[model samples]
Target: MSLHPVVLITGALTGIGRAAALAFAHEQARIVVSGRRAEEGEQLAAELRALGSEAEFVHADVRFEDSVRQLVQRTVARFGRLDVAVNAAGTEGEPGPVTELTPERYAAVFDTNVLGTMLSMKHEMHVMLAQGSGSIVNISSTMGSRGAPNVSLYAASKHAVEGLTKSAAIEGAAAGVRVNAIAPGPVETAMLARLTGNEERKTAFLASVPLKRAGAPEEIADAIVFIASAKAGFITGEILRVNGGKTAS
Candidate 1:
């Protein structure tokens, strides 16, 4: 990696994605923050610039191939190369049991969580493979490896993301490009509030974690920075769980 690598992050307007952008900026990495929200994206880019990191905001809806392609192209155009990519664009979708799952509901979750990840990796790898070096860190969840009751859609989507991350890692490994994922547990984010639905439910959920609390977004962001950095150079095709000991058993 260069002294100041160029990093591109999708779904960067809030939560873990937003925190990752800030973390990378503090490392003096040039960054491109992408999301559907133009206003928020621009604001994040400005904030990164204020930290003295070269930054830009690119509007991208990861669900669309053309949009993702343009996002990668624009990043390379502006920075000359893409050294890191964080695919954090995802949603909790409409949480419910398997019986309540409709095709629309499935598409709503899979499109963004699974298909979006695929598209992002597809385009990101194109540039990285040619460059012969890069790191891609995808966002996943602890539910990815465990069965959960109501949030079946979200869990299923993350399982697919892990599969994609492993497969992409194999494809990119020989080419000197690394692909991996960070599986977070319950984090303090807007999505968590929506997933749990109430303070009581939230407390119950946290109780399951050995930490007995929710993880802060910055904590996950710090892990992302390490996983995406050269410090984790030997790591690839692995899912690093940052779930507050939720999976320790």
Candidate 2:
């Protein structure tokens, strides 16, 4: 009902999620930053309010259904309605050869990256469908679209996210709620460092990209804001890639 949309971001304490929060704040959108860490969450909220965006920090762990459900409910309660939801909570699971993979490792990654996104979508959609207008963006990776060695679980999890986004989009389209995902390649985030693990490996990974460089979080954030904007009203079920030409070839 307001031109300045109420925005909710999960895993907002770091990486691309944090950047998206700042980007939306610059647009004067109301914000709710959700994370497992209350201290960091509250700090981010204060920072957003400092930027002139009305903000609140709602602690949430997407791996749990109740936490995610409470997060969406609290956002609606505080903001009067849900407008934009960004699912950015993900993990780079322990990398290993397929022969060395285990069930525990698989669940650890899927719980946060796959199941987490699903639960967030499930709860967010309930509110958006009832309101009859909203947008949801889930953060994915180039690995979602292509295969990668060692990080197969992470790749698979993101692939699941892509499917969830498209399925959710189709379900929400007629209800005036749009769902989409952003697939970034070699983003400059803590997760990237953890995945690459060393300078040499990081360099090699960047070289694989057609642009020969990693993308900044803010760059991906811009792409997300655009898709979440009314300018992209007709765009839904899209896995918008923001990977410096990583997939161009």
Candidate 3:
């Protein structure tokens, strides 16, 4: 791997993905910032370039195989290789009780959260395995390990992500590729706002965390960078949870 590796981050327009992009840029890694929004993706790419890293924005929707395939292909075309991939593209879907869920609801959540991660890893592993050395980080969630009310679909999708992570890790280890997932707790992001719905409810939810507050995007970004770095070379098939100790039971 290059000392300054090429990194691709899906869903890079905002929140944790955006934070990870900035963190990698600070490390001087060549970056591909991907998201569905053309304007926002371009703006983020510009911002990363301004930070003195070679960065480009690729429009992609991880829900589809072709888009994800092209996203990785374009990243390799631009950088010659992909050294790190952060499969951060995911959706919380509509949070509702299991009884209220429809097949459409399940598909919407699984498409992005489960299938998106799967497709992102599918394409990334193709490149990484050929190179014979690479790292992949999938963004999971605290819900992946345990169930939560009103967010069953999202939680189930993340559970699938963790399963994919471990299976890929085992398959890739012998081939010099690494796979892992970061299961973040409630982080301060737009997604969290949607999950909590309002200030009072948000505070009530935060009270459950041992830290008594939501984590910052930058904090989670730091963990992503670490997991993708050589410092974490021996680690794979692991779920690194960063949720203010919410899952520490």
Candidate 4:
């Protein structure tokens, strides 16, 4: 058995998830990275392997329960145990006002963000409960704490994630598992690029943030690594904001 712990990170192909994979790899943890993008996942796994860490790419669509269960089971079968999991796979739907939003778009966001995170946590917790120790980090957003225009459905879904994280953390604390959340501000990722393709809108969003700049995916990954490490053993049910001070306003 490997001396280091095993960490399974969802959405590990790009952006924050990819950054977290590298961060954990630096910590020498065995990494099991899962996502629908097989090419990206395999590419990332290769990079982690180059860093002298064990990495496996598992393709999963977190919206389905079977995929989530399979992800956990495969991690255990590969590394013999699971010590940490990061729920970071999510999407921002079409840019439209609440009244103009379609039910289908709303459902899609909820299915992937809210329900997917829940399923990841459910299956990971089942493994952790059997092991009796683990750590989980749910990737939330600043919108989770407050409402934002043109993203009502996405906001609502993240709020649901926050609620789930807190409630589940309380329940899992007794099992020696720590559950925490990270609410990141606008980070310079492909997702944010899609969110602010318009120059005027991008400038407006940047002006609203106190830092006057976007964050790096690595920054959010660092926060996840901190919470997943032994340093945060006593920290549970807490939401760490990595929003470049955006929530202060």
lDDT for 76 (candidate 1)? 97
Cα lDDT of model 3 by residue, 1-249, tens digit: 698899999999989999999999999999999999999999999999999999999999999999999999999999999999999988999988888999999999899988889899999999999989999999999999999899899989999999999999999999999999999999999999999999999999999999999999999999999999999999999999999999989
**Tens-place lDDT digits, model 1, residues 93-164:** 997788988999999999999999999999999999999999999999998898888888999899999999
Question: How do the residues 1-249 of candidate 4 rate in per-residue lDDT, one tens digit apiece?
Answer: 125889999988889999999999998999999999898889999999999999999999999999999999999999988999999999987768978988799878999999999999999999888888999999999989898789898899999999999999998999898999999999999988899987788889898899998899999999999998888889999999999889885
* Model 1 accuracy (lDDT, Cα): 0.96
Maximum-lDDT candidate = 1
- Every candidate's CA RMSD: 0.6, 0.9, 0.6, 1.4
Tell me the whole-model lDDT of each prediction, alpha carbons only. 0.96, 0.93, 0.95, 0.92
Q: How many Å off is the CA of 184 in candidate 4?
A: 0.2
> Model 1 reaches what TM-score against the true structure?
0.99
Q: What TM-score does structure 2 among the candidates reach?
A: 0.98
Deviation from truth (RMSD, Å), model 3? 0.6
Clashing pairs in 3: none
Per-prediction TM-score, please? 0.99, 0.98, 0.99, 0.97
Task: Supply candidate 4's per-residue lDDT for 117.
Answer: 98
Mind sharing the TM-score for model 4?
A: 0.97
Query: What is the Å distance of residue 61 in model 1 from its true position?
Result: 0.3
* lDDT, residue 103, model 1: 99
